[model samples]
Target: MRYIYDEQGVTFNYFLLTFIAIFLIPTTYFSLFSTDKDAKLRKPSCNCEACLRKENYLKNRKLSSTDRISKKLAIFVAVGWICFAYLVYKVTTVKIEIDVWDPYEVLGISEGTPLPQIKKHFKELSRKWHPDKAPEDKKAEYESKFIDFTKAYKVLTDEDIRKNYEEWGHPDGKQAYSLGIALPTWLIEAKNSPFVLGVYALAFGIGLPFFVGRWWYSSNAYTKDGIRTHTMDLYFKELRNNSTIKQLLDLLSASVEYKELVEQRPSDTTLLPQIISSVKEELDKRFSEKYQPSKRYIAPYCQKASALFHAHLLRINFSDEDLLKDKYFIAERSIHLINGILDIAIAHRWLQTSLRCMELSQLLVQAMWFQDNSLVQLPYINQDIIKTMKLKKKNIRNIIQLREMNDEERKNVFKALSPTEYESLMRIASIYPLLKIDQAYFKVAGDAIITPGSIVTLIIKLRI
Candidate 1:
């Protein structure tokens, strides 16, 4: 007989046994009429004809219906068992719980928590269950508990740790632990002892290589061509060896003492000569070594230093309107230099090259505005040129307004102007005319034009 629960061996065996018993009973009962003595012994006799007839009728009837029902019940039980097993597997294998205490939930702490409170909490907890205070009998248990408590408390209280926890969850701690991330081994040894050093070294010996291997393989560097390229490997090696780029970045940082000094008194001309000379010397040194300037490469750090020197020089000359004109011209030239450097950086495919260039560009733009020369004008300028220049300074709304205007509206704004008014506005728009010497020249030409009512010819010329 075909077993419906064949996939489930135990259930199939049970159904097979039940079917055998049903068939065997009917065979044994009919065996009483058998001529063979062994068959006759296995059967039970019925004297009445009605009993014999009933028995004979049942024996003749087909058992296929009962077998089919049994098969269906076996299949149903097997399916139920399978579903139960799957549910158990899912519950065990895919379970994930986020049980770490959230600082915000427990203590109402958030980004705005005061540093003093954090420090105070750390100190109070550290003192209360310090390992040394535990009784001899419970020292080991207490110390373990205390350690876990302190770790959890420290992570929750610290701003950085709390932020990381919020982002990644408690499992992040286990990952960090497995990765052997912690204070530097040397620092830990100095703070604690050689035992700590030994532990760290052992952990690092196993973890560092694994971590580094995973990173190297997982990153783009793992490609066969990337790995085989000697120049690429050497570039990375040099980057790893040199600290000059970091030092140069540190010097240019907003928090640096030099940066503070320059900001506090921007017009301090005394420092300009020294700064310029130092930067030039560094540039010469780097160039002589055949080191190309790049955002990633250490050699280009001198360029940043040079840019800073020029920025400082611009600052010193910022206040004098005449000097401001000269400074603006210099600033525009500096922008070109910066663009050239960015091209070189891009050629090298320097890491963070675009970001560095953007940062420097922003700094230069900010320095340009420091002198209040935003409205300055220059000699021999055209009004159309001034209008174009104004487009550069316009905010999003102004830009949208300009964009939305029909050609006729744009033309009417600039057409039919007298030569002197056009020239004066042009000069006013130029950076040089804001100089003290040129200031008087602008006043003379200010009212030299009057619109003669929408000159169509002039509008066509301007629009075209």
Candidate 2:
């Protein structure tokens, strides 16, 4: 058996392999870069008690459940890059025996030379090395050289042979052509064939289905909002149009996220009694017995989660390292549960519940309790400062009203804050969104007034 290399086919394979190399570079870079970048925690904007505690907790917290998975994915991406590099080297370096029969190269002259130049070149070559003129010692080499030159010159000058060469790139018309594959030849050699096939079988047959099945299972387990199906079911069962804020907090405490935490560290059970006692003391001081979370038949993990959540809302910092770590984890995961609850609320068109859910989200972000004065969000402004201001009945509870105060009144109210503190307060206030309504009205298209069941468009023009 003989193998012929197709020059055109081999060149095309080179071009394709080059293109694949270019495509892999950015993909490999971004996958590796993002995995590392996203793992870093950003600095908190405020150094308030809550932010500081949260930061400390996070610093001390255990690695997330997804860390191992991320590392595994990064490893796979790296391995793919290594394989691509190896394939590129193999393909580019492989000794390709392309059998291109170029007439111009055979005659040692450029293509498209004039007919006269072609004749002169052949005549010159024949004078020196034609078979008839060869010395006895070099007769065989001379014959081979003269034959190649005569054949190339005939293909360029003779009308019939030139026509054949133009049509088929060879003097003999329509010669056999070999097909080339882009992959390196050694990949399919008998010695390595079984290993290569086994790799294919493992990747496509076993690995593919394993990954796809894992993805399918995960998709079924969670809602579109990233909350588990059973968790969402629990939310649907417990939530109502008139659910109180305390009840909502309790509902959040009962999420499956806490169960996962307990499962990760069984010793968290030891901290449970201490956390429950601290939360109970804070609640007794702040609210009547009616506002407290009920102890009736809740899971012990749920009870611990509820205690941690209440501790966060009450702005109580823990001295215990393990308890604070648990608090941080609970607070971090609560946002997802809150958003999941908000999704259910909006789906049911429960306006009040939806608003409460949004408020809870804001509470988590600002690290303030529902009953705390909004002024406390400002730098250097605590309960003591708020008391001195005696701002009751002024309707200046929010930042907007505080911004609207007369210059004299504003100075008087903020006298207790340092200049730096006041500047920080003003900076934060300036960035807060305030929409001023210029005009608003309802209109029905093709009608003078909005009628029952008509599609009414409410147009409100505002300045930001």
Candidate 3:
């Protein structure tokens, strides 16, 4: 409680009445009610702590036209306050008033109060209102008042926040300097947004670990020995980790060179298995050599290995260009592609070749796992075709007649045979164990150099 004039006032009797009347007042009333732009501009709508304190000062000083309320409301509110103040003054000789929101006013202390004095006053007020000391009927009421006092004490005693309240009427004063409610100036002033920091954190913290883990998981891989290995691009003289297998798979997947080869399979179902198996067998034989592996070949080795792969594809009766240049085939049929490639690598017998083959094998296994195809898709024979051919075995032998046909005649014969018989019989010749194991056929194969446009015979030599 505070009084405009009192010698020994001691209670909030006058303060409560004064507090009610003060809110009814308005700052605009100081214009005597002129709201023109100039008047409004002259009297800004300030709610800063400075302005509120000034108003409180005026309210305590004396009654005057300084009230902020309109004339009519002021008349009613002022008369009502006067009556209450006078009644309490006569009955109790006590006059005290304080603004609830103003901590300085609530604590009955000036903004410039020293810390020691502030603490002393706070303790006195706290002890007076302590619930244990409060009257039974008024315990709850005193408890509420005690909370208000404690909050005020907390606000004023903190030097930094006290300064904030003195200047801005709020504990958090920096908000006054904000850009707007939507985005604070501090947010823009910062070097990076939280979102950008989050992305970097995700990449560095989680993404890096994931990539390394993937590399580690795929490190050890399948090799010609039918075992998994941790062989890196270089031999490790010390204990360390490597993950080349997954890395190679990623590169191969993105490669443009082997796109077609990865996807295309011979459309002739019966011939598909024969060509694939022949190629696989030959690669197996080349890789089965008993020799110590040397350090991988460099550029020169690459050229030789590449030429070998080309010839190797041809040996299995496939066009290298047709098979290795498609994209869908690479992405989808990588298993077959890797299988063939790895076999060639094993045949090379270089340390580099072995390592490269193991990497391809790892990739093939992973791709199969990814596509959920655990079992290899291989060519299957039809019983009907075998039975039909077996029934005509004698007739087939007679048809062949063992003639050394010229190129045109051989072409004509090939053209005459049904696609089924051509693929089936040719497959049997290539793979069937009971057929003649060792025979030789000689042909110039491509354009021959005799006299220009001269025809040549296709010669067959039997070594039985």
Error of 3 at 37 (Å): 62
Task: Pick out the ten consecutive residues of candidate 1 with the lowest summed lDDT.
Answer: 455-464
Off by over 4 Å in 3: 1-101, 104-141, 144-213, 222-464
Worst 10 residues of 2 by lDDT: 1-10
lDDT of 3 at 415: 51
Model 1, range 1-464, lDDT digits (tens) per residue? 22122222333334444555565545444432436442222221322332343344334332454457547755655555565555445445653443555544433346556767766765676677678988899889768756665655656666777666766765144343232232333434456777777778878987888898888765753334222233234333332222343322322321112222223234435443454564455434422322233354333223434444354423332234333333344444444444543444566666465456655565565442122232211222233444554565532222234435565654454454545654443433332212123222212223455445532222111210
TM-score to true structure, per model: 0.19, 0.70, 0.19
The list of candidate 1 runs beyond 4 A from truth reads 1-98, 101-115, 156-160, 170-464
Highest lDDT scorer: 2
Candidate 3 per-residue lDDT over residues 324-394, each given as its tens digit: 23322333344444554454444544456456546555534323222221111101212233234445452
lDDT of 1: 0.44
Clashing pairs in 1: 377-427, 377-428, 377-433, 378-427, 378-433
Q: Count the backbone clashes (under 3 Å) in each candidate.
A: 5, 0, 18
